[model samples]
Target chain A: MPYAIEVTDVKKTFSGKQEVRALDGVSFNVEEGTVFGLLGPNGSGKTTAVRILTTILNADSGSALVLGHDVAKQADLVRSLIGLAGQYAAVDENLTGRENLTMVGRLNHLPKSYVAGRAKELLEQFDLADSGNRTLKTYSGGMRRRLDLAAALVARPTVLFLDEPTTGLDPQSRNDMWEVIESLVGEGTTVLLTTQYLEEADRLANTLSVLDHGRVIAEGTPAQLKSDLGATVLEVGLHDNDDVARTASVLNAIGPHAPNISGRVVEVTVDNGPVDAMEALRSLDQAGITPTTFTLREPSLDDAFLALTGHRTEDGDGEDGSAAKGSGGAGDRAGQPESATVPVGGNR
Target chain B: MTTTISIPTVTGAPLATGVGARVRWAISDTLTVTKRNLIAITRIPEALFFSTVQPIMFVLLFRYVFGGAIHPGHGINYVNYLMPGIFVQTVAFGAIQTSIGLAEDLQKGLIERFRALPMARSAVLAGRTTADLCRNVMVVIVMTGVGFLVGYRPTTGVLPYLAGTGLILLFAYALSWGFALIGLSAPNSETAQVMSFPLLFPLTFASSAFVPLADMPSWLRGFATYQPVSVVVTACRSLMLGGPTSHWVVQAVAWTVGLLIVLPPFAVWRYRTRT
Candidate 1:
């Protein structure tokens, strides 16, 4: 099947006193009806790529095709085929939720009667029917985010571009958004989602791309990328700090080379986590380096991100933290790895 | 041999769309957006009060306080004379609301939402301009009512009165376009207000909205006489008060058309550049 979205050698540069290359020769394809995630850190050009694809910001160079129309030359056609829930709550605060949705429907060239019906359906679907008459300013952050999403879907666009849709919502709201996104894809709406959250990509995306510094460093199915890295990580922490190095050396002996130590924690990647854990424990006992705690589990998307970016996903001089905060907790929600407590490195 | 039934399927031809259809689409979208703006005016009554009521109050204050001190040889009542000037002044003052609304919309990310939509890129400015024109009409109505109450009568027939009103509306719409441009280009709402200051004083004071241009010093009179607002207000006054209206009417229409042609594209350009 033809791709729903195709971007070829896209490059965008913001020129001023200080020139910034927002996107540099970025290229990717999102299959039709698939949930595609563009994952990146703050200032990683994910939003820029999304913006260019959405026809809001023209790419300085490159060809982007959405629904068989060129984005730069046929922007209006591209816009009509796609719906975008921008990074910010771009809904009009002065207007009621129903009005916002209806406005979008009308903009999509739906007849007045159809617009009314679509707005009603969307309001009900998004669970905003109860407060549809209330202005957006009175709604909570989560409600606003949901309404923004609903507004984007008012036209029932074939290709939906959600740029950090659930950024600042509480966990419950994020889960609700996730469910909505899942259902959207189930109904055959191709989604191009950009987010800083790793789990979001893992859970929602059929295919995911890890971007850093305006380049896609990794792209695959979540399972494929995780398994490609080879071995699940088993994280072992000792109650005593002095035993960390000893524990690492013990695990290193068992794995022959994969154990790494950070402070009181020792991490080792193993093909068979449970069997390796048993052998490593036996070795630690002989060495008298008893670890207070150890757990083995599958590698997380964060681990994948770290492996690709060569740094902790959250360590970026507060820039990423602020960007995440600015986007409203969507990044942090996705940042929370589901297998968080899994011991690092027993699976080979 | 089995006979097969073959159904000929007919696909529809592409619709014969034109620029008119696109413009209509843009206008409809603009109206939809402006519906909320109109509702917002009611929610924030202060905007209406300031834009409409305060200007009328200023007219009353100026007429009673400063009217008798200044005179022209036409033997016209100060209030009657000031009505035309006040009409222009009120409409010009009312143009400030366009900037304020634009700034607020920009600050709130409303324009960004419109930008992402498939509607005409010019629809946002069009909607704003249309909405402000509606507000201008409302203000004009109230001003006219007050003028009637204060014994200011237009001796002309209904057609000329309507023509005079149309001229002011056109002039105000054009003037508001310039303000909208400033609002769209400003980095923030506060800065927009600051940026509009240079246009504000010169456009209002240099016009024949208050004192006659002939009463001013020679150099100042020359400038004021040629200012667009002066031409428009003089045209309005001539039509309403039964004076030679031809020269001023032509000048006023020309100025209105010229500004309308120039400013909207500039506003759209600024909007595109900023976004």
Candidate 2:
């Protein structure tokens, strides 16, 4: 299959009060007509990668090509072939939804005669027909996101770059966004999606690259990553918080990998489901650490993410990391305003 | 909103090459953005209202409050002198909208979106300054009506009055380019506003926009008389009130030409290197 996008050894560093190596020799290839997910914690250089591919920021070294056009040397050609929807909606709040779409269509250099009809069709497709004439200030967050996505589709771009597209969306809106992406893929458009949610990657991405500290640590299908992790996760919920370390030490012998802890719960991915479960319980009892709860379940991408990155995808305290929303997630910082500057690296 | 959206034909043709297509694309993109900004003004009419209202207040303030306090040696009415000054002042202040608008777009990530598009890079700044110029035209018209209400009459006929209006707008357009640089350099809309005012207050007040230059202190006279704002105001005064058209108009045109030559390329460079 021909590649829709190729990024090779792309590196970019932003120098200021402190230097941030936003993309440290990142390389990835996205096949035509497939969703390629870049999964990483916030500030791990996902936005930097997208900015490079979209031709918004030039890499310090290395090269990127979109649809065979060099992003650096032939940026205009690359820009004409790809569309980007950033972490923020990026649509004009003062203009009506219809006007914003038409504006983008014109900027994309679509035929003047074709733009109005195209904007109308996109508004209907995005279910924004009713509020198309109303200014975007009145639209809900979900509606604005839909319009933003629609605006990106104005010229029917062959490749679309979505940088944390569903980062702040509620569950229903996220699902709707996923459906829109799925439908676009069904029409044979290539997509490069950057997201923090493992489930979003699992559901949409045909292949995923897990990034950490501005490097791709693992790349595979969701099932491949999960299966490579282990067969089951031995989760031991300890009643006493102090006993957690002891439990991890006790369960450490069962799995080849080290035990992972969150609060009082200790989890380890084990190859043998029943044997490890039995071994974990007996070892805990012998150590005089009474388990508050215990369960041995199939490993999920969430477990795989934790195992590979050595940190949970969502805020560590959340019960289910996948369900957690917003910029309050583990490495996501809220105080600084988002700017054209490389996403800051202060989260570390 | 139209209820029924037709199934539109999709086209993904390659971009045309050569100079003509490029220029056409830039012009088309500029007009599109200008239309978007104009629509925004319509949605928030209060923005337009406040922009004009400030000039109107200045008209009332200088005419009623400060007019009686100062006398012109040339036997010109205070309202007549103040009207041309107000015209220059209003357009000069109106140019700040270019700065604030671009900064607001930058803050909201809209500028990033524009950068990613296939269109001409100059269109964003060109569109902004053009839209602000259009707004300045409206403000000039409204101020003219207000001037008439206060008994200010132009001694020149229709063509010269139009020429004076054109010169004021040309100066404003040139100033808008300078503000465009500030907008692109600023981190946000609020910063753009804060940064622009220090530059504006000094130019507008230090020039001959209000009182005559002779009444000012000797040290301030040279700077006040020759500054671009003062020259443009003097040019407008000559064109509207029947005076020697050559000297002041020539200087004002030269100042506009000089700014047009210097500021645009710098603003474009700022826009290009923003990332």
lDDT of 2: 0.84
Error of 1 at A244 (Å): 9.0
Model 1, total clashes: 22
TM-score of chain B of 1: 0.90
lDDT of 2 by residue, A1-348 (tens): 989899898887766444556667888889999999998776677877888888888889998988888999998878878888977789999989988998998888777678899899999999999999999999999999999999998988889999888988999999999999999999999999999877798799998787764677788787666666777888899889899899999989886879989899999889888988888888888988899899998765467656665555453522111111112222333353222212212121
Q: Candidate 2, which CAPRI tier? A: acceptable
User: B173-238 in candidate 2: lDDT tens per residue?
Assistant: 999999999999887799999999998887898988889998999999999999999999999999
Q: Give every collision pair in model 2.
A: none
Candidate 2 wrongly placed segments (more than 4 Å): A231-235, A271-279, A282-287, A293-306, A309-348, B1-13
Best by DockQ: 2
RMSD of each: 7.0, 6.7
Model 1: CA > 4 A from native: A228-305, A311-348, B1-16, B149-157
- Candidate 1 global CA lDDT score: 0.77
